[model samples]
Target: MITLDFDGFKSEIETPSEDLRIYNFWATWCAPCIHEMPYFESVVKDTKGTNLVFVSLDDDRRPERVKAFVEKKGFSSPIWLLSEKEQKDWKQKLKEDWSGAIPATLFVTAAGKRHFHTGQISEEKLKELIETYK
Candidate 1:
């Protein structure tokens, strides 16, 4: 897990040189979101050297609390805190059908392609999806 915020995310995912950009939107408060942590971590572990940017959708007013939550849980994946505007903007860009769901994840590679999962994903299935990209 590598820590990144809005600008860093732009540099990584928006970069022309990078390949396989993954964005996982999560929060510490959501149970389902918490449950999906291990899955993303497993993805990071299994897909070493792949580009994955994890962003925290927690309220910006409580960044310290969010940071503490991650620390308490001993999370292995790095996270970026999203501003309210950032969250709203992404929800629109991703899909209008979304109700600003938590535990939402998106994957994009240098090929300028995209993949999305709105709910929890199994480890085996994630491995297959990642390998497909490889």
Candidate 2:
């Protein structure tokens, strides 16, 4: 797992890649985020050639909790702690329509196509989106 500041996150999102990348913004305290995590895990298990990045929005002071939660959940996908404090400052940089909502997802394709979702996503929806990009 990696910890990234706003600039690093921006660079990652801007960079192009051949594989489909799914960036899921979540926090341990968020009920909706927790509720939808299993769907994400299932997607990770089912998807063959995609990158699943769990971008954690937990408090910067509680890194251990985030690490523990990831470990406890047994999520093999690479996890990232979003270290930026000023969410308002960087939210627009990520996506103009992003409202800084938990359980938000950003899908980036090899061809640079970007899709943003701002709520809990179903497994079927995730698969559909992956199919569109893959």
Candidate 3:
């Protein structure tokens, strides 16, 4: 897992690409985020032509704990730990109305369209969004 500040994260995913990129924002302490882990893992394995990345918002001081959690869950998608400490600064950068919620998802289409969902998303909805956006 790589640790990224806001700028690093933006640079990572903001570049133009032909693939549909899905960034799932989560943390180890967030239960709903944890609950949706397997769904994301399953989708990443079964889906084609799409890139899924898990962005962890866990405390920077506990990098080892975050690594252990991801290892225990056996996540296959690329994982990046967000090191930004101020939610107010980065929340709007992700979305205008984002409330700093966990289980949020940012979908970037090949066509350069962006879709953001804030809160727990069902596996069905997740698949549906991918099909619709990809």
| Alpha-carbon deviation at 36 in model 2, angstroms | 1.8
Badly placed stretches (over 4 Å) of model 1 are 1-12
Q: Extract clashing residue pairs from model 1.
A: none
Estimate the TM-score for candidate 3: 0.94
Estimate every model's Cα lDDT from 0 to 1.
Answer: 0.70, 0.84, 0.87
Clash number for every model? 0, 0, 0
Candidate 2 residue-wise lDDT, 1-134, digit = tens: 78788988889987978788889999989998888887787886778878888899888768899999988988887888888575668788888877787889998888878888899888788888888878
- Residue 103 Cα positional deviation in candidate 2, in Å, after optimal superposition: 1.1
Q: Between prediction 2 and prediction 3, which has the larger TM-score?
A: 3
lDDT of 1 by residue, 16-130 (tens): 6455666778877788778867777867776765665568887777778887887888776667776665665657656567777777777776676777778766678767767
lDDT of 3 by residue, 9-91 (tens): 88877889998899999999999999998998788678887898999888877899999998898887898988758556888
